[model samples]
Target: MSIKVENLKHIYAPNTPFETIALDDINIEIKTGEFIGLIGHTGSGKSTFIQHLNGLLKSNYGKIFINDLDITDEKISLTDVRKKVGLVFQYPEYQLFEETIEKDIAFGPRNLGLVEDEITQRVKDAMQLVGLEYERSKDKSPFDISGGQKRRVAIAGVIAMKPEILILDEPTAGLDPKGRDDILRNIKEIHEKEKNTIILVSHSMEDVAKLADRLLVMNRGKVEFFDTPKEVFKHEERLKQIGLDVPKVLDLAKKLREQGFDISDDILTIDDIKLEILKNLKEK
Candidate 1:
């Protein structure tokens, strides 16, 4: 029901010109049903870290425990691990190969040897979760959909597996503003309805700021902080050093604070800040 990583380290092409530390002595714990926003600049090891959660990248250098099962142990079932921790990588839609959207979404569940009826239900339910109309899109080729809808199909494929831990790396990458907003809302629905341990990786502080209950900031393969968004944004200089700024909402809050606004806490979301501003105006 949780993921625990200790001293995780990964080196790429060691002893060669491409040698680099991809993950450096990382340690963190993720509890069940927690919505975590994983934020870091490009090459900050965010992808590398999430890959290890599902056994996609084995770590001989560190130990990872998922749901209290040692992932590295010989007795562990990697297949089960993957079934429990579903990962949706950037451009996941590109991996879609089935002739029809229904088949593509059903692939994972089918592989689990689910009954035909169960697989069908899973496909229907997953598509519904992603806002895809099962009756309309089922027979259509995945390539025939809009880019955002294609992405939804890919994500539905993973959700069909009913993974306990869902890791989404830049789920909104390359999306337009409205596409990004739609995807973020879909993810929130998934978290709320499924109650999975969700880890959303993105560089956009604003996107994560609105959805994440907790933020995990990374820099140079190291964890900077793992705390509630309000608490984490309080370290403005530390975030700046990592080439990240606090969410603009919080930045505005800070500026208003200096100008004699009596706002007492960091405002991490657009909605919350708007409410506060309106309340203050009404009071005045």
Candidate 2:
């Protein structure tokens, strides 16, 4: 769904001596089915901003419109907002508490008052969407799985609700390389097949480089930039000044270019860089 934010501002502990400005005069637009990478350093308002999208946190200074409806209106129900926007927080597995994986993933659909058959179908679809075998995992306790599996199960719970906009916050945090790869694969698969709008809030510049169609860079409670990743990553000095790094692949490309290897500075993905290296080496 399309989302538009106008003059959004959020403050914590307002009117207090320890008050902090969490979000400031922020405004942006998102198209339906677009993959947006929300990037920032710690305390850059990334977490706080996503909360406002699903109405978990309300903004008093501005309004948010989802599909042209002002969610800030008193008549809008938070439940309706949440149904359209699903949020998967960092280390989501920590929230899983059901007796079986099937039950855990089915929780959201069940809460939506779907019939038992529909809930069961949702549980199966969600599990498969995350790369888990329905028959093998359905009966297992959530606690018995590996860390990554448990994390997927948690995400499956949110996916079972069939949200139009999926927001994942630091989805690959605290995982081994293999586990991180698995989760990213699931994310890619779901986005490609389901065609849902995705907003990925992450600190990993490399992950954003590989996954996001557009980049939204935030710094010190303000939007530093919002554009395509290629355009945004061009501001290497500014990003570094704000405590963010360009993608590692881009850094490698720069070093390779300096070493007399012909390559573009805007290279963002490892696969593209690898091909460039192979082609340049052949020319050598």
Candidate 3:
């Protein structure tokens, strides 16, 4: 499914002396089966915008459409909207409360009122999808699992519902290096296998640079750039001006370019930077 937000506006503590505009005239579109990254500094409205996607927060002004359905319509069912656009908030693992891992992962499907057989199947599929072994972890306490596995179990809870559009807000906020990498890889695998729209909100430039096919940079409640990663990162100076930095390798490539090398400004991955360096060395 696709999603579109037009002229979206949200104000926290509106009309009071503490009024704050969290989002201002925000516009965005996500095509079906696309992987999109939403990046912004703290208090830049990134979280505010995603909350509107699944009706977690109603917009003060503007409209949201999910596959031609106006989510803002009073007659619309938010339950259906949420089922289609599942949101996994930051530190989702903290919300797990069931006694066993299987029960925890089954929570969403059970809430959906799926039949017993279907719920069991969903729990099994979701556990496998997140790299958890169903036969091994089903009866164990989720709290006893490793930190990374616990996070995966939490993600599997949402995956069990099988939403068409999955939105993850800061999925790797507190994980260690390996945990972060594992979560990112699992997310990529899920997106490719499910062929669903994926919206990832993250502060790590490196993570988004590697994962997202398209990038949207937000600044002060406004979209600064919305394009492919190559196109967005090309504006290195502007990104830095807004307190966002380019990927580490891209920054290094820019330094190389400043030294009179013929490296392309669009270089993003470490492999791309290596190839450019090798090519330049060969040229000399």
Candidate 4:
């Protein structure tokens, strides 16, 4: 589904002593089947922005449109908005509370008043989508699963709702390297197979560079840059000024270029760097 935010502004604790503007005239447009990455340091309004997409947090000013429907309208149901846009918050595993894995993953559809058979079918489908064996683990307690499994269960809960757009906030946070990679791969697979729009909120430049077709950089409640990863990462100095860094490989490529090497400064991945170096050596 397409998402559009126009002149959005959000303020925390309005009319209070600690009033802080979290979003400042933020405007963004995301197309269907696109993977967009949002990057910023802490307190950059990334979290607050994603909350607005799913109607979790209402905008104080401005409007959000999902597939041409104005979500900010009072007549619109927040539940309907959420059904179309699923949000998996940071550390989602902490939110798993059901006794069994199947029950936990089925909660969303069940709450929507789906029939028991349909909910069961959705639970099985979600588990399979996340690479879990439903029959083997359906009866087990979610608490008894490993950290990665628990994370998958939490994601399955959202997937069971069959959202057209999936918004993940720091999906790799607080996981071992293997666990992080596993989750990232699963998410990528789902995006590829389902052709769903994805918005990834993360602090890791490398992760964004590798996954996102476009990047949005936020600073102090404002969007500083919105463009392709190559365009956004070109402003290394500006990003650093805002307490962000480019991908490590891109930084290294920049240094190599400074040293007069025949390499592209836009090399954002290890494979790209290796191929570039090999091609240059062959030409020499």
10 residues in a row with least lDDT, candidate 2: 257-266
lDDT of 4: 0.92
Candidate 4 regions exceeding 4 Å error are 258-260
Show where candidate 3 strays beyond 4 Å: 258-262, 278-284
lDDT of 2 at 284: 81
Report, for every candidate in turn, its global Cα lDDT versus the true structure. Answer: 0.90, 0.92, 0.91, 0.92
Q: What residue runs in model 1 are displaced by over 4 Å at the alpha carbon?
A: none
lDDT score, residue 158, model 3?
92
Residue 11 local lDDT, model 1: 91
lDDT for each residue of candidate 2 in 1-284, tens digit (9 for 90 to 100): 98899999999999999899999999999999999999999999999999999999988699999999898888999998999999999999999988999989988999999999999998888889999999988999999989999889999999999999999999999989999999999999999988999999988888888999999999988899999999999999999999999988988888888999989766899998999999998998
- What would the per-residue lDDT of candidate 3 be over residues 146-256, giving only the tens digit for each residue? 888988998999999999999999998889999998899999999989999999999988888888989989999989999999889878889888898888997688689
Model 4 per-residue lDDT at 139: 98
Task: Give candidate 1's root-mean-square deviation (CA, Å).
Answer: 1.3
Task: Please give, for residues 9-106, the per-residue lDDT of candidate 4 as tens digits.
Answer: 99999999999999999988999899999999899999999999988899999999999999999999998999999999999999999999998998
Residue 220 of candidate 3: its Cα lDDT?
A: 91
Best candidate according to TM-score? 2
